[model samples]
Target: MSTHPTTARPMDGTARAAELTARTAAGAAELTRRTGTAPCLATVLVGEDPASVTYVRMKVRRCELNGIRSRQVVLPAGTTTDRLVEVVSGLSADPEVHGILLQHPVGAHIDERAAFEAIAPGKDVDGVTMHSFAAMGFGLPGFVSCTPGGIMRLLDAYGVDPAGRHAVVVGRSAILGRPAGMLLLARDATVTYCHSRTVDLPARVAEADIVVAAVGRPELIRGEWIKPGAVVVDAGYNPGNVGDVDFAGAAARASLITPVPGGVGPMTVAVLLEQTVRAAAVQLGEDPAALGL
Candidate 1:
């Protein structure tokens, strides 16, 4: 493990993400050179929600810069759940498309689960599907939910081993909280999950050696609740650029902490691109290990 400072040290996720991106770009270029098929990620978007549009554009731009191809499939706001599923299924069946990322909040009416299931497990780079969750739980090979995966990477980069630590994940969202806990458990950590119904949330947080605030509510986990020398990963990005943990207070107590905008956010997209390249390598029948992915 790495030595911890007296005060909280910023995890610097943006810098870490850049490191992953550089490696992924090389893997992507090498894959293309060997197989003549550029790694491609298909992003499916429903409706034109401004935030979603901007996020998709950012992902596409990143893909372009990293030597990965991007294919966008847009659907109307009123598109039926089945229609959305059909589009995703087509992308899954497309041999050239190596990874599938279905942007979420696809309107309240759309069956988001069905749309997610339409993506083949092999191409689920964003890791929203149940198969990915199961894979993560069983320590099998599969793409993980990007945020959770990124969080693990951040922990590894900081040399904070989860083994034998009590990790409290305060959220139960399908893609974030639950998966985060599962990943932690797979690393031999004693994992506890707390959600909206969790009684005395602060008390639960206070006992953790590692705290992951993934619930979207802003500053839900107070700094005073954090144990001294604990590692805090604030995965929440609420409006106004605030995190679930009160930054100043948590930073004062924690040995390591992730900031709101740069901490977990950049790592999500970096992992997405990294996994896309790996997916392409697998689909191309090239060994990812041999390619150094």
Candidate 2:
């Protein structure tokens, strides 16, 4: 029903992410120059899921490139929830650590929420805490869950206005889908959340002006279900690097669509690093505004 062009434009997330990362690096360098303290991100990973390990490695590498320091904490798969919480709490208490990121899907037996709460709100750069979720919902200035924050950034970069738009977020995971909808709602978009239990999922998705495919199932959101000219933000990174949306089919119908590897993934890291620099500035008593926060 939309009048926008059917010839879709690929949103160049890689380029935008690079631009933001460069800016963050510059800001980090300046902050370090002023305070003699580089921004530090402490990453905690429980049970080495290969994907999680690779993600953490990528984050650490980006930190190095951006002049931020990374401290790695690796726990065995059998570690208890309490031990994990203690480790995160220890990092939170360390004044030298400016930010904390506990990688997702920390072993099946561990209480993820309890472990996440161990991170101090100020240092939760990954934005997994209840406090961060509240702040995001209220449109307050606080750290956001990285992927959702990155999606917002992508929307802005592409000149997509979210106000009054009907946005369908197709997942409800604590970190990805839920927060993404909240962020969209904060920007004045009308948001509907859909999951496995939702009735007639395709019908619901077709009604959206903006579609965010965050469900882990690859190609779950078929291209035919995309409203013509709608903006599609694919946040899923399934095995084989496929996104939740059928990229080929959706790209034909969407006015703007993100490609799998080059889209949301890069931006996630960029936002994380950017927030780490900001956290450092705040913790060091340096004015974040002065660093172009």
User: What are the candidates' C-alpha RMSDs?
Assistant: 1.8, 1.0
Worst 10 residues of 2 by lDDT: 1-10
Backbone clashes (count) for model 2: 0
**Predicted structure 1: lDDT:** 0.94
**Model 2, runs deviating above 4 Å:** none
Checking candidate 2 for backbone clashes, the offending pairs are none
Candidate 1: segments with Cα more than 4 A from true spot: 1-6
> lDDT of each prediction vs. the true structure?
0.94, 0.94
TM-score to true structure, per model:
0.98, 0.98
In TM-score terms, candidate 2 sits at 0.98
What does the lDDT read for residue 123 in candidate 2?
96
